[model samples]
Target: MTLTESSQSLDELLKPRRLFRRLIAVIADLRLAIILLLSIALFSISGTVIEQGESVAFYQQNYPEDPALFGFLSWKWILILGLNHVYSTWWFLSLLVLFGSSLIACTFTRQLPALKVAQRWKFYQEPRQFQKLSLSTELKTESSSSLIAQLEKKGYKIYQENQAIYARKGIIGKIGPIVVHVAIIVILAGSIWGALSGFLAQEMVPSGATFGIKNIIEKGLVAASPLTKNWLVKVNRFWIDYTPDGKVDQFYSDLSVVDKEGAELDHKIIHVNKPLRYDGVTFYQTDWGIAGVAVQINNSPVFLLPMAQLSSKGSSRIWGTWIPTKPDLSEGVSLLAKDLQGTMLVYDKEGNLTSAVRPGIPLEINGVTLKVKDLIGSTGLQIKSDPGIPFVYTGFALLMLGVMMSYVSHSQIWILQANECLYIGGKTNRAQVSFEREFLQIIEEINEAQTPTLSVANEIKN
Candidate 1:
């Protein structure tokens, strides 16, 4: 092989490494990090505005094409962009992972080195070195030991080289930014884990029904199926409580977690805001509806009829069913109930309001004595399992702690004693006025005879 060709080949091999370094540098840049965070925020807001993890028909009905939302967003566009499942989408997770990498890179490449420099102490040997400090001054005072004692009293750690001295306090201030970066990275980890392992489902179970989790609205890429345990949940009873004015106060579901053989393991009476949690799975009561009603005509067996909720614009809910009074099913009456309060409105064959009756009341309709028996109710529940919640909470706590620690000023002072003249200087990350006052006190104590020379405190006497 020719030498020129081999050199070109080697350059090609090294090109990838050079490109990798450039990419890493760009990712570690603060501007890129800000842009990434903003992009994530914008997309998160989109996730909220557009309903997530819903059926295709729901999106189609809600975001139809002819007069699209925002003049452009249709259901097809939403589906194509994966906006319906933003949190679980690959691009969203990629943004999170990339932002976390940036944080880690910045912590190692910038923050750690900066912290190391702040903690390392070196005495200022030359007068020119002390001249560079804004707070430095040449005091014709000889007492350097008194300065060290006063600094120590003010919570500064002292380091000395021959007659030159260095003191610092609040090193935790330097460490705080790094802690913040770590906390953010931990939060990202939790979010990624949750998006990859959590699951959500909804169930509308009738009273006295037993079933395993079947309908999953959304599931992570690696979610553990809730059906793995083969556990069955039975809705022992469902009911609604009403106020004196007949408004629904609350609804409840008596539930039991059982095995395949119907052996009960755990039980709870769940209502709104109160849920049943078992083995990392939680069931929240969300809604309630009438399932059916039972009726009997004189001496005949009780017949169960399924009830369907009617459409209404207000909070008034009503479920209705038609019961045939004649055997040929030619004549019938409609039974409608607004609540489980035993009161119902009976409608005649011509849809006219016939009578208002309650359970156990005999109402003569179509030449028969009909008695209302019972009303069955159903409970709607939302079930979810998120294993990353603990990590997210821990990271949140660390973030708060780190933010508080960052507020502390990392004050540093340098004093060089050359023969009779003592050179003193100091700097701090925050609270400039307070640090200046403290520096003044240290100076005054070091030279009790001569008025201390630092930032002029002449206005103090005024």
Candidate 2:
């Protein structure tokens, strides 16, 4: 290749490299980082305000088509924008990835380089450098050794070359931003990992029933395998406690984790705000309801009847079931229950109220003697698994530590000895007034020490 062509080729190659450097510089800018942070925060707020991971029908009902919510949002818009599952959406995840990239870029381009500069030691070679300092003083001293001792006593990391000395303190303050960036990266990684691999499922298990996880309401792409092939949980028993006003105070479920061989691995009695955890899975007690009722007819075998939740139109809770009193598919009565207290209201086939009976009560209905058995209750549980929570918490802890460390002032001092004159100057990244006061105190001490030396020299001369 010709020399001119080769030179042109090299310049072209350098152009792209220079462009890339400029881009990195822009991305690492503090203003840019603040803008990106605020943007991420705004999107996160949107995700929280607009419900996530809901059924299509639910969105359609809540955010209708005609009026639309806030005159702009509708079910179609929500589905199209992936608002139903915002955190797991491609755009939202991409935003997080971009923010993490920004953090990395800033850490490498700004924080680490600043720390390196802070760690480096440079001797003051000229008096002009001292003049540039915010706090500088010219003083006469006997030797540099005494000043070195004072600097050491003040906790400065001293570096000496000939008669010039350089000292710095609070270098950790320069390292704090790097730690903060690293912590933010860790938290972002944890959040992405959890969103990609976590699953949320709900189960309404009747007491004394053993089942596997089958009812998955929300799940990520990789979450299905973990849930479908996991352990079995059994509801040992479910009950409720009532207060003085006959209102339910708490509901509890005795749950057990059983292995494939039916051996119990763990057990716990869980209620509201209390949960059972085993093998990375957590089961939370969220609700309770009536599952079924057991009843016996005169001289007949006992039978269990499943109860169905009745629509109350926003007034009260009720569950109902029909029990056949006769064998010819006729002469049946309706049973209604309101709570776990086991009080059941009976009605005839014609919908007329018959009687209210409790458990172990005998009632004569349709010329048949009937005895009420136990009312079975079902435990509503929400199950979830997230492997990244530990990382997230650790990241937050580090973030707080980094913030505290960043508060320390990074201070630097330079000492120059030239032609029987001493020049000293100091500066700090923060707390300017306090640093000024400290510098003045050091000057005062040097003046006091030199005054006695000057007095002795004058007496000897006389």
Candidate 1: worst-modelled 10 consecutive residues by lDDT = 449-458
What C-alpha lDDT do the candidate models reach, one value each? 0.90, 0.87
Off by over 4 Å in 1: 1-15, 313-315, 327-330, 449-462
Estimated TM-score for each candidate: 0.89, 0.93
Q: Write the per-residue lDDT of candidate 2 for residues 57-123, one digit (tens) a residue.
A: 9999899988998899999999998888788888888888878888999898878888988989999
After best superposition, candidate 2 residue 308: deviation in angstroms?
Answer: 1.5
- State the displacement of the C-alpha of residue 378, model 1, in Å, after optimal TM-score superposition: 1.4
Mind giving the per-residue lDDT tens digits that candidate 1 earns over 1-462? Answer: 999999999999999999988887888999999999999999999999999988999999999998999999999999999999998899999999999999988998899999999978988888788777758877887767777778888889999889889999999998989989999998999989988999999998889999888899889999998889668899999999999988889999999999899999999999999999988889999988888999998779998999999988897888999999988999999999888889899999899999999989899988999899988888999998887777899899999999998999999898888868998998888999999999887777666734544335565655
User: In terms of TM-score, how similar is model 2 to the real structure?
Assistant: 0.93
Each prediction's RMSD over C-alphas, in Å, is: 4.8, 2.2
Candidate number achieving the greatest lDDT relative to the actual structure:
1
Error of 1 at 390 (Å): 1.5
Where does candidate 1 clash, by residue pair? none
- Kindly report the root-mean-square deviation of model 1 from the true structure over all alpha carbons: 4.8
